[model samples]
Target: MKITFITVGKTEDAYLKEGIEKYVKRLKHYTRLELVDIPELKNTKALTEEQQKSKEAELILKKVTSQDHLILLDENGLEFTSVQFANYINKRSVTSSANLIFVVGGPYGFDQSVYARANDKISLSRMTFSHQMVRLFFVEQLYRAYSIIKGEPYHHQ
Candidate 1:
């Protein structure tokens, strides 16, 4: 199955962008990897956090399709070990969806509508990280998960 990562804004840090690109290249050796960035909302100084999230959610939802299995990378979502995460990826591949899409929201996180549309939610860690950094972390984890799945000796207990 093709895996897609949909996130808000650009990765402004050169280092972070390079790290994300490295993993994206590695992940392609295992499966189809699609990286999509939804532009950040403009002129948000007057908007409430909720309003910003709502507007962001509109852009996010437009990228999704009915055939895609939507998952959100949320702090409150389920946490798993590296092996368990690999297993989760394996399980998802057997499902009917052609694409398994993972979403990372903006600073205030996802709106209620976006949450409702999600089929599952995953947490990378309990500690908070910037949204841009999360893209790098998630892609690296994706690469790690695939390596584990293939018994490639890239991960150790």
Candidate 2:
């Protein structure tokens, strides 16, 4: 199954961009990875946070399909260990034929509409992270998950 990772905005910092690229390159060996960056909404100074999320949700939802198992990377979502995440990946690959689409929403987080459409939610950690940093962490954890699933040495425990 292909894994499509969708993020709200481009990774601007050079360091974060470099780190994301590193894992993305490594991920090619295990699965088909598609990276989609939805452009940030322009002139957000006027719009309320709720309105901003609603607009972002429209763009995010457009990329999704009925056959896709959409999982939102949300702060309030279920938390899992590296090994457990690997297991989650393993089970999904074995059981599901649909594409697995994971989304990281904009600054104010996912809109209620977006939440309503998601099939599942996963939290990287309870602590908050910058949008850019989450991109890198998610990819690295994904790569680590793949490595662990294959019984590779990347993850120690």
Candidate 3:
């Protein structure tokens, strides 16, 4: 199955961008990987955090199709070990043909409507990280998960 990774804004840091690209290229050896950057909202000086999120939600939802399985990378979502996450991905691949769409929301997180549309939620860690950092982390984890699935030496217990 193809995996769609959607994030808000571009990775501005050159290092972070390079790191994300590395894992993304590695991941493509395993499955189709689509990286999407929903351009950040403009002129937010007057808009409240909630309004910013609301506007972002509109853009995010537009990328999703009814056949896609939307999964949000949320702090309160389920946390899994590397092996367990690999298993989760394998299970989904065996069970469904739908695209696995994962999203990293803007600074304030996802709006309620976006949450409502999600089929599942996953947490990378209990502690919060910058949205840009999360992009690198998530892509690396995706690569790790695939390596584990293939019994590659990329991961160790």
Q: Could you estimate the TM-score for every candidate?
A: 0.97, 0.98, 0.98
| Clash pairs, model 2 backbone | none
Residue 133's C-alpha lDDT in candidate 2? 96
Regarding lDDT, does 1 or 2 come out ahead?
2
Candidate 1: worst 10 consecutive residues by lDDT?
90-99
- In the predicted model 1, the residue pairs found to clash are none
Per-residue lDDT over 1-157 for candidate 1, one digit per residue giving the tens place of the 0 to 100 score: 8888999998999999999999998987999998999988889999999999999999999998888899999999999999999999988887565689999999999999999999999999999999889999999999999999899998999
- Which lDDT tens digits does candidate 2 get at residues 1-157? 9999999989999999999999999999999999999999999999999999999999999999989999999989999999999999889999999899999999999999999999999999999999899999999999999999899999996
TM-score of 2: 0.98
* Candidate 1 vs candidate 3, TM-score winner: 3
